[model samples]
Target chain A: MKRNIRLLIEYDGGRYRGWQKQGKNADADTIQGRLEQVLSRMTGEDVQLIGSGRTDAGVHALGQVANFHTDCGMSCGEIRDYLTRYLPADIGILKVSDAGERFHSRLNAAEKTYCYRIAVPGVPHVFDRKYLWHFPEPLDMKKMEQAADFLTGRHDFKGFSSIKRTKKSTVRELYAIDIEKKEKEILISFTGNGFLHNMVRILTGTLVEIGCGRKQPEDVLTVLQTKDRQDAGMTAPPQGLFLVSVKY
Target chain B: MKRNIRLLIEYDGGRYRGWQKQGKNADADTIQGRLEQVLSRMTGEDVQLIGSGRTDAGVHALGQVANFHTDCGMSCGEIRDYLTRYLPADIGILKVSDAGERFHSRLNAAEKTYCYRIAVPGVPHVFDRKYLWHFPEPLDMKKMEQAADFLTGRHDFKGFSSIKRTKKSTVRELYAIDIEKKEKEILISFTGNGFLHNMVRILTGTLVEIGCGRKQPEDVLTVLQTKDRQDAGMTAPPQGLFLVSVKY
Candidate 1:
């Protein structure tokens, strides 16, 4: 009997080429490609795994949800163990369960959260270089907070995404934007109905520029209104970004 | 004019040979070697860096102190910046200061603290793989605590050292052994007057064995008395070990 299996995954995406299996190196390097390979080996059949979203290269995830169809009779617990034992150390299966036959991870998702970590003043932790964006000197928290406020609503985010050919609407509803500073690190978190390609990173870059006094908080409104990617701040690097959670 | 300098160093030792620069690979890799190279180039003089002690390859440090003598007149802050700019991302100079001409990082140190991180049961964060030992099972905390209590105070730790030939006394005074669990990670902390070669790693391995029911709490005393390396548990890998602090 074929069954739909859902997996809650965690990964340090520094080594992968992102979530989707694309490009010439897709089959060997991407997260989905790796999962499919492991699942195919485990079940002795080809498996198609669908991710809720595509996280860019060097983006980490703590609660990425994926679903796959398999005819194998192995228990969910066994499958989780097998994946944990065989998968690379940078990827892990946090939870496994049986899903309804028609459950789609991407289509059923309601919201998503992404967090970006900034190491200010200096990089104090050598082990965290893969996970933090080191931004030297202090930032103007008030200005960044003010800029974040301007971004928390339904709007056309074409200026934020990198994709230009998509026929889909650029509108996305941002539920929340929380900026928290702890010690030398600042964590900017975003909750939204969905994100477009490079949207979160571009948003982070723009906010950081505001924090650094390169741009005023009100400039965000103009950037959004123009719907031009060139008018926005530079795209931030991917190492600091994390898919915090997915709501379905 | 020659000046005495003290440096507070932080390094992700995953790629280096060790703290001390030795063998034919010296000057190419190794924390000490890298630091010396940078200092030599900055000051235009050959430099010798004396660390608090030698750490094994792959052992990380947050506060490993070192001292060196230089003839350069650069300010401490400038020297710190020079080293920071020249050294690789994995090795960093956290603080630099003028020291007494006679001061030595190893000789003047009163105590040192080391920490070992163990990931238990489920691996939730893949980013922490390089800094944590993944032990995929429940550990008996009570047993580990009891074993740690036995290890506190003065004890001849010859059995714990990996050195096969050494005339130095292995009698070391351990100030405390603290075992704390933070979510899925268990931290094993040790404060001691000094430690022998591979002492901290060996001690951790034996404690973990006791925690997993492979050895009893009372066995620590017997291992110390025997003064035989073979009687103790396997030496734990260095990736999970950290030189947390060194007191002057």
Candidate 2:
């Protein structure tokens, strides 16, 4: 009997190329490969786990959801314990629960939230270096908030996505976009039904340009209206972005 | 002419063994080595940079203070700008200032503060994996605090020092020792005139053992009294320790 299990995963992406398994480089470790290794060893069978989405290289996730099918006859706690013991230090299983028979981690998700963090001091924090994008120059928060307001509603986000070829439609419904500042850290959060390839990073880059006064807040609406990838700002670095949560 | 220059040094201790260049890896890429490289390039002379202290391999520092003799007639802002543009991304100059010729970063220091941060949970934080020690089990704050109190005073901390040989005298004054809890993180801070080799880590390990209920608070005082390396608790990992500040 195949049992469905839902997993809440937290990973440090700096050590891995990304979430997907790519060609082997001694350094090409991925989150998926690490998960499969621990699961396979625990169950004594090859288990392929599927994630809700593929996070880019150097991008972190605090509440990433993944699911896998197994016949180990273990309770959720047992599975959690097994994975916690065997998984590498960078990948953690925060929670494990039984999923509905037909539930899929990716397709069944109702919403997702992502946050991009920036450290204002050009000098990197010795502690938070791996988790933030460091820009030494002081940023204008009021300008960033103004630009973020233009990104709040549903729109054709083709201009804000990477120019990668994909089968999935480029249309994404952004529910809300908010910019919050705390001390020297600036957090840009996006809540949406889904995100296109590089959508959050590109949007962040555009807003950063606005915060630095290189671009105007109205430029965001123009970029959206153009529906051309070239109209958007450069893609922000991967280290700053984090998948915060997935709503079922 | 001796020009007193205050340098903000950043280094990845993973490449070189530690902050103080000694033994076989003495000439390796240390924080001092990297700082010297940039300083020499800027001034066209051999520059010897003195750090606040030596941090072991895999240890990191954010506000490490160092001073170098420079003949360049550049202002502090100019030197900061030049270093920011030339230094590698891993290292940065937070600020530079002209100091009095008699000033020495190591000698004029009044108090040195260190923070030992532990992440409790089996899975390492992807972002902080390189910087924090991941402990799976829940820790008892009461027990840890009780054990820490025993370490707050002038005492012979020979038991906490590294077994490796040292020319410096073993007696050091510990002004304050505090253990704080924030969310799932535990931060143990040590403020003193000086620290013995590996003193903070060994002290933290003893407290951790007490928190786990493996040892009693009174055991710490006993270990201190014994003045025997073997009598102390296990040495905590280096990743959890940081040189928080050097007061001048």
Candidate 3:
């Protein structure tokens, strides 16, 4: 009999391609691949790890969730300790416990919160270089906040994504967009039901452009209505993005 | 004619062999070596970059002070931009400014502050792995504070350092030791007039040992009076230490 196990995970994605494992004959350095490899070894059986969502290359996660089925009789405490001790330094297992049979990581996630960090102009970042977007130019916070207003609430975000075509609905509920200024960096966090491909990055890019006076605060409205990808701004780099949490 | 230049620097010392450059023909991957290399090219002359002090390999710094002399005609802002743009991402030049000809980076410094970070027991630290010491054992804060009290104030700290013998007096003024408990980590900061080689790490090790009940809190007094390195617990790893600031 197989037991369902759920995991709370976190990782620095800078070294991996992304979360998903590309099949054989591809660059398969991925979070999922590493998890499956470690779990398979621990359980002495093949394991299929399921993640809540996929984060892009160079991105990071602080509270990612996953689940898997295993036939191993090891106690949850033993499994958690073994996994944490065996996993690479860059990957961490926050929690491991038995889950209900019907629980699914991806299907059950309710919302996600992602944060983007921009180094404040004229500031130096060394230890945080891999975790920040070192944008040196001064930005207008008021303008950025005004633009963020346009992105809040439910909308068709097809124009703000890289996906040229998708059979799935492009509609997503953007619950909130908060821009906060820390001592050395500006943090922008997005809480949403779900984000389309590159939607958060694109939205960040558009808001940044508006903050820098390259675009108007209201331009995001037209981009949303027309659903033209070209109307959106550039896609922000992945290094600055962190999946802060996934709520179920 | 030569002019004096002072630099406020920061670096992630994980990649380099510390702040001071080991002389030619040795491991030259040092923060000072990189700074001198860039400054030499920018000024069209061999530059000697003098840092406030040497941090061991794998240690980090946030406000390290340094100075150099050169005939380079570039403005301070230009020099700052050039150094920041040319240096590796791990090394950062926070500020560049003209200084009095008599100023010395090391001698003129008044006090220094260093911080050590330890991950809380059973917490996962992925993105912050390099910056934290992942000690899973529970630590007693009250015991650690008791140990710290014995180390505070003016004392000959010979036994707490790795050095066997030195003509320079081991007597130093330790102003304060602040232990803070954050959500996921415990931070200990030390402010002192000067620290001997391996002093901070050894002191941290001794304190940690006391915290874990390996040694009694009052045992630190014996370590201080005996002047024997073995009396100390252990030298904490370099990755957990950060040169927070050197104030003049």
Candidate 4:
């Protein structure tokens, strides 16, 4: 009997080459490749795992969702144990459930959330340095929030992404952009129906530029109007970005 | 003229061989060794860094204080910059000050606090997994607190340590042992005048055994009374322990 299994994965992607199983070092470098290998070995059948999206290298995930089809009769609990026993410490399976045949992780996803952590000035990067981007300069919250206001709407985010797609629309629904500062860290969260390639990071970088006085709050509108990637600020590095969740 | 300097240090301690600069590996392996190397190059002098105390190889520290004597004319700010630029990412210098010649990191410390982090059942080990000790079984907090009660107070804690010391007094003042559970994590905090070799880990282990029903809460008193290491529970691993702070 064929079974469609859904998994909630958490990973410290500092070492992996993102979510896809590509390149010459597939099995060793990619999360999907590693999962497929273990699943194939456990079930004695090749596994095709589908990820909702591809996170860049060095990006972390607290609630990454993926689905796979297998003919194995092992219970979800048993499979979880098998994977937990074999997978490295950096990756963890938070939940495993047998979602029926019609569930597709990528197609069924309605919204996604990503959080970017910035260690503000006067803070020392110590133990968890891998997950934070140290921005030494103090930022103006009012300016960043103003820029965020212009960014949270349905718009052509082509100017805020690296992709130059002709066949598909670059329009995306950005539901919310929340900027919260706690102690020495600034957490910027984004909830959107979908994000174009490098869109969230570029949007973060653009807001940061406005916060640090390099750009004005109204520049977001200009970028959206121009629909050119050059108008956007530099893409924030992958180390500070985290895929928070994929919601159906 | 020798200038006495004090440093506030923070480190991950996952890859180093404790705080001391020893063994043939020397500069490449230990936290103190690495600091000494950077300080030597910056000041053109062989620096001797005295830590508050030695932490085990895998133990982390958020406020491990240290002091050194140097003839370098560099300002504290310049010295901090030099160390920050030269030291690796995992080790951070939170502060540098010119302490008086009478000050000693190990001698002037009046109190010390250590924290142990345990991830309880249903929690996933992901990015910060290096710092947490994962115990799958649910812990009995009331039992652990009972054991903490028996362990607190001024007593000879020889049985809760791996050391065999006869020259020095084995008795020490254990001011408090506070255990708090938050979500899926439990933090066990210990404050005292001083601790022995493997004492915190051993104490945590014994408390855990009591919490898990492997030992009685009153067994801590037995271990202290007998003054035998064998009467205590197993020594916990080093990764979960943190040198939270040292008071002057």
How do the residues A108-199 of candidate 4 rate in per-residue lDDT, one tens digit apiece? 99999999999875566787788988876788999999999998989999999888767798999999999999986899999999988888
lDDT against the true structure, per candidate, is 0.90, 0.81, 0.89, 0.90
List of clashing residue pairs for candidate 2: A12-B126, A122-A136
Better of 2 and 4 by TM-score: 4
TM-score per candidate:
0.93, 0.85, 0.88, 0.88
Ranking by TM-score: 1, 3, 4, 2
Clashes in predicted model 1: 0
lDDT for each residue of candidate 3 in B1-248, tens digit (9 for 90 to 100): 58999999888989888887888744359888888888988999989988899999999998899999988899999999898788888888888899998999999989999999998876667777888887768899999998888889999999999988789999999999999989989999999999999999999988888888899998889988998999888899999999999988
Fraction of reference contacts reproduced per prediction? Answer: 0.54, 0.40, 0.65, 0.71
Better of 1 and 4 by TM-score: 1
The alpha-carbon lDDT assigned to residue B94 of candidate 2 equals: 75
- In the range B140-182, model 2's lDDT, one tens digit per residue, is 9988887777888888888888856666777778888888887
- Summarize candidate 2's per-residue lDDT along A110-133 as a digit string, tens digits: 999999999876454545766888
Off by over 4 Å in 4: A1-3, A23-25, A41-45, A69-82, A98-101, A135-142, A210-219, B1-4, B23-25, B40-46, B70-82, B97-101, B135-143
Which residue pairs show backbone clashes in model 3? none
Docking class of 4: medium
Ten residues in a row with the worst lDDT in model 3 chain B?
A: B19-28
Q: How accurate locally is residue B162 in candidate 3, as Cα lDDT from 0 to 100?
A: 91
The TM-score that candidate 2 achieves is: 0.85
